[model samples]
Each structure stands twice: as C-alpha cells, then as structure tokens.
Target: LTTMALVPQVRDAVDLPVVAAGGIADSRQLVAAFALGACGAQVGTCLLVSEECPIHENYKAAVLKAKDSGTVVTGRIGGTPVRILKNPMAKTYIAKEKEGADKLELEEFTLGALRRAVFEGDVKSGSLMAGQVAGMLHEVRPLRAILEELCGGCRGVLERMEKEGF
Candidate 1:
C-alpha cells in the first residue's frame, strides 16, 4: 500500500502519535502525510545523497542515478526483504535467493558489503540500501539546502493545492 493509504489507517488504529515513513522525500509527500493524520515523517533515501551523509561517494552516485525501477528486493525466501540499488551483487543475491540457496551462504556472500560501499566506494558489489524514493533524488546537495527545500517548497505546493481546492 502507498503511504497515503497506510498512514491514515495507522493513525486511527493507534492511541499514540503516528509518524509516517517510506517514500517521503519531498514537501508534497510531507504535506500529504500531515493531511493523512501523521504527526511527522521520516525520510532516508533523500538524505543519503546529501553532502552530510556519511555513505561513500559511489553509493551516493548510485542513488543520484536511480530511476523509478532502479531498486530491487532480496531475502524474499527468508520472508525478510530489503531494497537496494540494482547492481551485480544484488542481482546475483536475488538469483541465489530465488534458487533457494542456503541463507547463511547468501549472508556470508554479502557480509561487509555495506562497509565496502560506505567506506570503500565499491558500488559494483556493495549494498547500496535505498528506498523507492531513490528515483526522485537527482543531485548531491548540502544538508541545509535539502532541508530548506523540503520545508520551504511546501508553501508553494500548499498554495497551489489551496488554489485548486484540494
């Protein structure tokens, strides 16, 4: 389900405050979360490309290059899927997992891959963990500018929506 569908249901089901997450990369999404009854939103992929993010340059570049179909999920056989950018290693992992390979073998094959990406800039084999919103990111930006855009852009979107009677 989309965030628009899930956030309201969660808000109504819980007694405590509900914070929305997933695919919340920009002001339009942030505003939608509020409209859906979320007290706040949590964003990650958008920030991963930020200048302040500690991930390796190759990882950030992969995120910046991502398209709508850029990410894939692995670990489905184990009933625990994770989304990461498409690459040789991810493709191989998905193939092995689908073939019902040993879980420990797959785990060993990808172990330290995250460190390889973040520290060694190994985009070809490292795990470039990201979200569906990876497609929305286009550039490397400083944290301040990214935050300002996310917050400041809301006024314009809100104004447009109000004018259109949203």
Candidate 2:
C-alpha cells in the first residue's frame, strides 16, 4: 500500500494508538491530525527548545535564533528539503542549488551529520533537522510550560469550535 494508505492500516492494526510523524507543529496541527484519524502526532522540530531536550545548546540556540523567514527548502542535491537551522553548510548547499549535478557534492551533508551537531556539539559538520515552525519559538521554555501552552491553545481551539448551541 502507498504511504497514504498506511495511515489507516497502522491505525487499525493496533488497539493502543497511532501518532503521525513529520512536519507536525502547533496545537492546530495536532488537532487536525486527530480529526484525520490519528490518536496523536509526533513533533520533533518543536521540541528542539524544550529545557530538558538532549539537543546541543548550539543547535537549540541556532533554532531559537532563526527568523520567521530564515528556513529554505532545497531539493537540488537529490535530497528532500528539510527544515534546518541556518548555518554555513546549509548556506553553501543553497548557494550551489543552481549548479545542478555539480551540486551533488552536497550529498556529503546528511541528517546524521546534523544529529552529530545537535547531539554532540559538532556544529561544523552536523545536520540539524528542524521545521519551519522553529520560527514560532522564542526561548528555551521548560517542558511543563511548553505542554501547558500547547494544551491551552488546544483547549481554546476546542472551546471556540464547540457545537453552535450545545
């Protein structure tokens, strides 16, 4: 079955629950996923800044430093455009996007490398997988604050969307 078809299959395969991964951010996205048959959604990029995250300080710092317009999605180097913290490696890859096959040199840059950067403090050669939503965050809030805020937003949305007269 196609990836699209896997959702219902996986959801039905287990009695526990299913959480959708990839690109999910904010309370609205979470709610929408559930509305689409998911029990919960996974959020990786948004968690980069939680006070207890294992990500390196520089990685989180880079994400928090990102601007609303900072991220770029590039597919020129035979890889999908993944949201990431802006850094020298990312910048260079973007600059080479126009070079076509010449840009294939960028393959040397991988998400695993970024993980090294985010998890091992090797900013020079690590890939930092993030989401465009990183722009929405400002500081390293505690885990409780993050959950509370998300829950508050979800509550507000649910309350506002409650049935007309009921």
Candidate 3:
C-alpha cells in the first residue's frame, strides 16, 4: 500500500499474500501484521546487520552504535521525510533549520560524503540510510542467525500465546 488507507484495501482487495513493508523491525511486528491480515513482511533496516548485506562494516557498526533516537526524518529539502541515521549532515541540517537563506549548500554534501563512508568504508564522509530499528541491532551476525532468531522468537511468542489460552 502506498499509504495507510491502501493498507487494508490492498489486504482485502486481493487473495494473494500481503507483505507489510514500512517500519517493520522484529518478530512482534511480523505477528502484529499477521493479526492485521498481512501474510508476510519485507524487512530492510533489520537486515542491515546480516552477513549477506552488502553494506560496509562501518555501516553496520553505525547501525550497532545507533540509539533509539539515532535516526532523523529529513527530506523537506528535497521532498519526503526519509529516515536516515543521525549523522553530521543531518545534524547540520537540523541546526540550520532557523538560518533560512543563510544556509550553505555545502551542508547538503554531507549526505553524499556519508554514502561514501558507509558504502565504500570511507568513514570520513557518507550518510547511511536506516530506520529507527537500527538501534535494536547491537551486533553483527550471520544472516542465518538473524533468520533463526526471528523464527525462534516467533515460535516462542506463539507458544506463550497458546499457554495463555489464546
């Protein structure tokens, strides 16, 4: 669904699987989505730590180091509010919010530098695009382990619910 209204509409409009995409982080979300009639989920930020993820080690480190509020939603300068890791670029933009016409274009280049740092391992610059869930990941592990943990957590929750007579 492109927006909230389309979520349920798409879920009911067809019989095929409905995979929730935005803001998904962990097993709880998967279950909640299922409860909402979604058949599956498409994870992005949650997989940044996966061994199979092509992002640089520094990128994953940034994800691991992120706090619950480490990411900021920005994009008004361009268009939409994109969720990105709180980097120097974002910091500068936020600080310049009041400077108005005094803002320098050089600040925008910080994001590009962040890209170089994350994707190319050049920590001196480049911004990493991540979601709020980046804070939930504290370590880098094999993709297999991530999936195993996800499935195991799901099973545990299901077992708990069953024990509760649900």
Candidate 4:
C-alpha cells in the first residue's frame, strides 16, 4: 500500500512493526505516521534534493519548483504507477496514455527518461520522480541540517501535543 491508510489496519492485523513510506517528507508527517500506527518512516523524494544527493541540478530545481499539485502518477500504460514531476516528458506520456498508447510505446517513451534527468540535466524531457510532499521541500540543505531540522521539529511537535493534551 502506498498510503498510511493501510498502516493502522496492518498494525492491528499482526504483531509486527509497520514502516510507512510514501508522501512522508517532514516531521509533521512523521508524527502523523506514528499516530497512524507506523513505527518508522521511509523518506525518498525528500532526499533527491538533498545536498548530498548526486542528481543533476536540473532535477533538484524541478523538485524545488514543484507545488503540491505538481506531481502526477503515470506509467499505467506499463501497468506500474510511478509518481513523477509534471514536466514536458510527463505531459507527453500522459497525453499518449490518454490516447491509449500501448505498453511498448510507453516503455519506449520512458526509457532513459530518468537517466536523462539524473545525469544529463534534461528536466524538460526527463523523468523527475517525486512524491506529493515535494512541495514541502524548499532547499538543498546538508544531510546533517535536514536531520537536525526533522528531529527538532519532531520534538517541538511532541512538546506541543503533550502540552495541548493531544
């Protein structure tokens, strides 16, 4: 499941720890995950723009410029949904899908799209994979700074919750 909607149900179904992934970009989301019965959170898109991330600057810029509505889930033509930024390449793919493009056609279009974005800095014609939480990210900070902010925010949130009787 790509959503935390399943976290509570899964946690209640078995005696196992649940790690939530997808759309978890900030400390508030982390707190929400815990409230939803998740013991841990896996962050992905948030790191793509990290200072330590080796992705091309174009990819990072695309992510940084994105808004909450900037991402779209394509790849249904290939039977696997992938969330990516709404760039020229994604728009073309979406248009093709709307016209009932075949799997082979979709594969051909997306082939090397990610590589182009990551290595060649072709944001317009490349696949910039991101999550809905991308808009929550603003800058490319160092890993240490990112971690510290998250932890500090988490603490602040916990303190507020405790004081407010949440």
Candidate 5:
C-alpha cells in the first residue's frame, strides 16, 4: 500500500506507532505523515542522491535526471513489483514481461542488474531503483544539508499551522 493511503488505516487499526514509507522525501511529506497519524517517516529513494549514498555515479545521474514520470514499476514478471528508473534495462525487462516470460526467466534476466547499476555504473543495463519523489531531487547534496532541509521544512510547516490555527 502507498504511504498516505496505508499509514492512516494502519494507524487507526492498531495502537502501535506507524512509520510511513514510500514517496516521502521532504519536510512537507514528513509533516503530512504525522498529520495523517504516522509516528515517523522512513525515507529511502531521496537519499540515493546524498553524498553518503555509495551508489554508482550512473545511478545517481539517472535519478537526478528523472521527473515524476521517470520511474516505472517492474518485476511483475517475477511476482515482485519494484519501482525503478525507466532505463534500457527496465525497458527490456518490461518487454520480456509483456511477452509472458516465466518467473525464472525474469529472475535470470534481472540477476546482478542491481549490482551492475549500483557498483559498476551501468545505467543502460542496470536496475536503477528509485521512487516517485526522484523528480524532487535535483542535486547531490551532503547528508547534513538534506537533514537540515527536512527538519527546517518541518519546523516551518508546524509554525505555519500554529499561526493558522491547527
């Protein structure tokens, strides 16, 4: 389930804290998660462009170049859906899926695709895993800067809410 849709439902169903994931990158998202009853937000794709991410430059470049429409959910052929950038590798996988490739064939095709993209900088033949928020990311900034922006954005949002009465 997507973050916004799932977080509240889970939060209401149980009394445990809910940590929302997927499509959460900025402070605005963080605030929205809390407003929707999430106790915290788990951020991943946004960090791919951070200086500390350790992914290949090619992977980072692909993510930086992505727009909201840049990502596609692949791996359906293997019965596991994954969101990744729309690169040559993803296109091939998608085409194969359309041709009714079996799960084993799909697995074989994607074997080492992630490693190639993450370590070998093979964007054309690699799996560039990312999220919808990849479009919001423009530059590779330090982790410190990213944290600061998120926190600052959250604080600003809270202040605005307080002034506007909730």
Candidate 6:
C-alpha cells in the first residue's frame, strides 16, 4: 500500500502510536502523516545529503543530481528488495535479475558494491543506496538546518492545508 493508505490503516490496526516512514522528506508529508493518524514521521533520504552525513562526496553528488525516477530496487527476485540510486551497475543488475540470472551472478554485482560507493566514491559500479526520495534532495545542508526547516514548516503547511479544506 502507499504511505497515504498504509499509515492510517496501521494506526487504526494498533493501539500504539504510529510513526509514518518511507519517503518522508518535507513538511507536507509530515503533516499529512499526522492527519492520516501517524503521530510522527521518519526521514532518511533527506539526511543522506546533510553535511554531517558520512557518505562519500561522489555518492552525495549523485543523490543531489537525482531526478524523481532516479532510484531502483534490486533483489526483488530474491525477496530482499533494496532501493538505490540508478547507476550503470544498478541498471545492469536489474536487467540480469529480470533475465533470470543465477544467484552467484547476482552476487557478483552486490559484493563490495556498497564499500566502493562509501569508500572509493565509485559511482559507476558502487551501490549508491538511497530512498526514492533522493530526487527531492537538492543541496547538502547542515543537519540542524535540515531538521529545523522540516519541523518548523509544519505549522505553515498545516495552516495552508486547513485553508484548502483538508
């Protein structure tokens, strides 16, 4: 289910407070989660570009350049889905996976991929793992700035939504 659908359902299903996660980037998503019965929202992708984020500089560049459709999930065929920024390695891996390549062949693509991305800044073949929200990340800002904008904008967003009859 979409976050919009699942958040409310999960909240209704359990008595505990629900925190919406996945693809949460901006104020609209934050407030929408609360409206959908989520008490909070978790963010991951937006922080990947933060100044304090320890990812390689080249990897950060790729994320900053991402378009809305720049991410893809691999290992779906093996029941271990992972989302990463689309690179030559990711494209070829997905193609091979869909063509029913052997497990060992698939492992060849993944082994050491993340290490390459994180340590070597190898954007060509490394696994530049990021969420689908990578496209929304434009610049590298300090952690404090990112969070302040994210949290501080919620009231304005809520006001706008209310005006729009949400």
Best by lDDT: 5
Report the CA-based lDDT of candidate 3 relative to the real structure.
0.71
Model 2 clash pairs are: 113-126, 113-127, 114-126, 114-127
lDDT of each: 0.90, 0.70, 0.71, 0.88, 0.91, 0.90
Candidate 2 vs candidate 5, lDDT winner: 5
- Give TM-scores for every candidate, taking all chains together and pairing residue i with residue i: 0.93, 0.68, 0.75, 0.92, 0.93, 0.91
Candidate 4 lDDT, tens digit per residue, 1-166?
Answer: 5566788888899898898889887788889888999889888988898899999998999899999999999977668999999988999999999999998889998899999999999998999999999999999988888777765699888898999998
Cα misplacement distance, residue 31 of candidate 6 (Å):
0.8
User: What tens-digit string does per-residue lDDT give for candidate 2 at 76-140?
Assistant: 35656666666676676677676563433566545367668867876655666677778888899
Whole-structure CA lDDT of model 5: 0.91
lDDT of 1 by residue, 109-159 (tens): 899998998999999999888998999999999999989999788899999
- Candidate 5 per-residue lDDT, tens place, 62-131, comes to 9999999999999765779999999888999999999999998888999999999999999999999999
The digit string of per-residue lDDT tens for model 3 on 43-162 reads 788788888888899888888889889888755554445677887766766565535523255355453665685569664345677887787888888888887776558878778889
Supply every candidate's count of residue pairs whose N, Cα or C atoms clash at under 3 angstroms: 0, 4, 8, 0, 0, 0
Pick out the ten consecutive residues of candidate 3 with the lowest summed lDDT. 98-107
- Candidate 2 vs candidate 6, lDDT winner: 6
List the pairs of residues colliding in candidate 1: none
What are the runs in model 5 whose C-alpha is more than 4 Å off? 164-166
| Runs of candidate 1 exceeding 4 Å displacement | none
Please report, as a residue range, the 10-residue window in candidate 1 with the lowest summed lDDT: 73-82
